[model samples]
Target: MKQVPLHRLFMVLLVLLASASCREQSRVPSQAEITAISLKRGQLITCGSSDKKFGTVQFDVSCSPEAQTDFNLALSLLHSFEYDEAEKVFAGIIDENPACAMAYWGVAMANFHPLWTPPSEPELKKGVQALRIAQSIKNKSPREADYVAAIAAFYTDWEQADHYTRCGRFEKAMEALHTTYPADKEATIFYALALNAAAKPTDKQFSKQKMAGQLLAALYPNEPNHPGIIHYTIHTYDYPELAALALPAARKYAAVAPGSAHALHMPSHIFTRLGLWEEDIKSNLASVASAQCYAQEAGLKGHWDEELHGMDYLMYAYLQRGDNDRASAQLAYLQGIKKVEPQNFKVAYAFASIPARYVLENKDWQAAAQLKSRPNFPWKEFPWQQAIIHFTRLLGAVHLGNTAAATAEMQALQANHDDLLRQKDTYKASQVAVQLRASEAWIKLQAGHPQEALVLMTQAADMEDSTEKHPVTPAEVLPARELLGDMLLQLKKPQQALEAYEANLKRHPNRFNGLYGAARAAELAADGTKAAYYYQQLLRVAGAAKSVRAEINAAQNFILAHRSPQS
Candidate 1:
């Protein structure tokens, strides 16, 4: 009221407003307070409940009290890669509370699917729309705004940026968000996920993946029931050297979220890596059933993509264990499915690889030659997937001594490989290169170019050894090192073949062909003790399985002939 300086009066008013803001911040609701408010609205909010069975994730956001529980549930589903279900839950929250900005963030997150294929054009459009909506909603806190911006990084200029560039941008954004809030568990977990998503498949040292693994491992003890922590822990360590480290998470993830189809299936990644076929089989069987149930509940006309993925694992595990009867059943099941609900890269890989794997693993060359690509799939969009069929045919032709057929199949495969290279998919193109070189080496051997064939095959094996398998594949359709062993065996160099087979077994243990090849190599090398040891191991692994595979019989006869008469 006095004639005070105007600027000083303004500064005093600002201080008073700041003090009032601090008082409001101090009155922010606790979890219990929110729960009581939620209860008053007849909403029972709890983690680990049947309706929210994914895992425990507490993401505090400025939303309606009733929307908080659903937001957490949706975030948990996003962690499990249950994108469709998570989107539905997030949409429900938006419907209940139109100002819930985090629900829109969840919607955008669901559409992106960082660890899977890049979003389709429609999905990208939907995500961009959702992000714009979340940004428009002014009720979100600063942290919520940061979360929205982090995902917005992915949607930014998506049409102009490649998948890798977009992922890198998103990862950089998440890293910045985590750095800004080191105490926020959600930011830390998401940062780890982004790291793994941006990891290069060809990085021999696996720097990014290992770093992500360490981050997740640090979080594991406190968040053992956390779906993202355990799920991402498995993903980050999904390599030959690191897989053993993930065994604990792999063993625990399925039990932690048995309702999630992806969780039920993810443990098999480690089991498959360590050659734990029985456990892989069990994990995938549960996943397949869960996926089937999900498809039914969602009113899908065909099997869910997850079911196809699980069946591929089931086929691989069954073949590894010499359970041909069950393996054939899986093949039949796949052959019957004309379509999958979401025809993504994972589904495409499964569709092409399952049949190819069955023939290659069983060494059914005739069937391989006759292997037809399933109809109704968008094969034109997936040339790398198309390469699978041609590669199978090339191998079959080489085995059957059909040089012309082999040459033709090789040409087709080379075209597919070129297409992949043109598409700038270097990792997959390198895989195709492995297939082409291995097939050409076999063709060289058929033409009596033994030394050239050996050099070429050895190069293929070394190149393949330098990289790790993509998550889409359980293993190479046929490991080139194993092929190197086979070629040496054919050329009457059993010792070198044994060395090759031994090297392959070190990486791909308990594979039926690898084990049988090693035993045969040892037998031909006149190493009876070693041969008996391998044969006995084979029998111990697959003796109970009902199969007429000649390798199994050979192992049985070898074991019987070497038996002690006294025993």
Candidate 2:
């Protein structure tokens, strides 16, 4: 034996170790191996026999045996929008079973929302880094790898892409994920949400949303208590045309996830859309309580943003129902909150909007003109928040017969629009600009330029018609066409005004404003039958309407004085 030196022996050992590593890398897990990872009978935390009935979906995943229970619970929580708890469960799995690639995937996904706001810069970076850790893990199944790859593709150029573009990529990836695993109901559900969210407001046909609705609706039979099924169903059908289709889910969702503030509030999306003021009132009241309770449990002294959000909706319902005393009281409560958590997106929107809603919904132009951001939050930091305040200001100016003031307020709206565009907030940019245009049309009408007003308002209506209303605003805010009808009525074009009112009713059926406007327009146009019918409907919902006593009296007199021949 040649007595080799120590350095030569070390080099030989290194080569041998590298060779063994390559051989191990060649041994990829098979489909059979993947299937073998299903949770054992006793592996899960028993929630009775049917976890599905308990509002939990225990999906099988190819993860470490030690992580099966944690993985299942985390996935169930994630699917229900319980992100905080889900992240905790995911972290436990990641700590105990570092080799479980999907644990990192779970943690990464906990950082992203497919339908809500896109991840902030730091959040996007965190998700990508987590996924990189997942990809570093070996012995992952093909399916698991595919899941990771899909998410990676979505975030591939996230920093370079606009939020819409990134969302489109994520949606496309989710589509691929479901196609690859059609039977994976979780994939199907998540993908449905992506399809619904990917559509621009301009996609009025709701082609993608319709597909989402079908997918979510089909899940109800087997997963009746599935929170995602119920919650996402409300989101899919949260439009005037489809809200009735979602009533069952909306009615059931709050019960299924009673502890979730969002779940408690989500049912009211449909309730509000369909003018179910009583139901909306009950839902948001419950939601406010739930949010406070959740905040207390989480060791927060102040209420969560969710509470403010629910309060805003509650205020809107109160206003819609002519509960002005209650609405004004709620406004005072909001204005007097010792502190507001405006850092949260929900709180910021609600903070800006609740006052705007209180003033604008009541048509109190003078109060709106005098309104200021009471919370003293950095309005510039939240442009959409600032935009809401300015919107009311512009409306107040236009309505009070002050074109110079209205034009000045419109300039503020233009500034917000430009800022939103600079920030890549395409949806709010378009929406705020539409609000500005609506005010501009009103200003033109005030200046005695009726034709110019009509042209401007018609264009505003067309732009607004292209999109569904954003849930953040009071339901009446986005329908510039309603203002078009008001202008048309002002111009004494009763037939045109009636058409506009009828169109508004088609999208926001049975609302007091639309019904009343249509009734008045019909009366002016000499369509006695249609006028009588709309007046009756107006009186039906008039119990909840305010500032319309004169209209209500007129409607009643007309209905009584002109009884139908049959009657």
Candidate 3:
């Protein structure tokens, strides 16, 4: 060949390198490529690029080729949220492959998402039947077990899912990836995600995040920039202790793939939790900004479904910072989006808090009361919220001089008390309801209806004793008992008030409010000796408040001067 100019040679080399880069980018594979990549990475192999070709490959791998093709098509339809089409596809799969396990799994998965689909008993039974058939065909298939177990789990059948996951029968569901051929990076990433989803949130020692992190770290050690691993490490791991390790990893991943939804959502969730744990609003707001930017990008790319997934963290962060306007604005935006009903509970609860903030800010009980009656009031769905709504409504009614409404709300709240207490898993709801009843009684006392308050308080105390058989944390019962003591004092039942306060003090040794209430009740009972003792105890426990200390000292002086002459 003739000697080429150096510049021309350089241009030729540049073109070659550019062509190689383009080839790599254009190598996006079909579904069949997913399987092929799993078996052979870094190997150049050409397969059919069209969906029809992939369908043929899928048919080859499946035990029942027609059934497998139908099942895969159904799943693809389901992923597109075409429920009617997916159902038809699944039905065809079941018809062709009557023992097709995944056909049932597809139906179940479809029912679980979108939140609008009411999964009937028949559907559940069908799913279970399909799972049984699948199990018979291949007892080693973990995915079949997982699908069956998930249906059980969704119906609050935790015991069933626990059984399968513990027995390792659902290991395929927990696999890092699934492939018709061989697993690839995408498969691994998705597998880790599935595993994380299947992991229990309540496991004290082994959290979902930790399990996810371990899986990701093992699978993608070479790709430190992998979004799946980094997101898991940051969002799932307990913060502060692991934040140093996870934050750097997350930042690196984001730098590499700034547009990755996983990267965006994970950091947002992590920072929001960190803020709540540390009570650091500034850091949380910064994270929210990143989340919003990434979430918008995801939305623009027809990924609105994923965008809706993590907006709750952003909504809550705003709520925590007392930015009700921002919270309300964000909530409105979320509501405007399609398929937001799945997350309605969270968004509704945030809105419910708005009236609470209004109450605190304006002290406008009338406005708060009116807000409670509005449609879509979340308290109607959740017991704790209902209790809070009723309690605040009572306050608002009292402020508005509407005793009848207040009394009616109180009765309604009390009616739900027994049902609330029966809920074992929802302890917070029970506690809040109890506290609200106590508050209602206190309001009666404040209104100068001492006898009414006394009756309500006595009933609350008795209910607390009956409902909670085992000893709970003292903090849990303090609010109920504290209000009861106050009601007793208002009723001029000083002896009973003193007893309640003393009992609470015994449980919570250093509680300043209990000691103070005890001293006040003793004084009301004209027992200078006991009153002085409680005042002295109150002085010791009241760490802050020099003014309170001075007042206690003055009371002690008065008690000493008025000591019973017999003593």
lDDT of 3 by residue, 399-449 (tens): 677778878777767654655566442444455655566666766766778
**lDDT order of candidates, best first?**
1, 2, 3
| RMSD of candidate 2 to true structure, Å | 6.3
Q: Which digits, one per residue and each the tens of the lDDT, describe model 1 over residues 96-191?
A: 775677887887899888877778888888788777767867666899899999999989998888888888988999999999999899998999
User: Candidate 1 overall Cα lDDT vs. reference?
Assistant: 0.85
Query: lDDT per residue, candidate 2, 137-237, as tens digits?
Result: 66678778888887786678887887677667778988998999888888888888777667777876888889988888787788887777787888888
Q: TM-score for all predictions?
A: 0.90, 0.87, 0.43
Model 2 ranges with Cα > 4 A deviation = 2-54, 64-66, 474-478, 542-551, 563-567
lDDT-better candidate, 1 vs 2: 1
lDDT at 461, model 3: 70
TM-score rank order: 1, 2, 3
Best by lDDT: 1
- Residue 232, candidate 2: Cα error in Å is 2.4
Best by TM-score: 1
Residue pairs clashing, model 3: 38-182, 38-183, 39-182, 176-191
Among all windows of 10 consecutive residues in model 3, the one with the lowest summed lDDT is 39-48
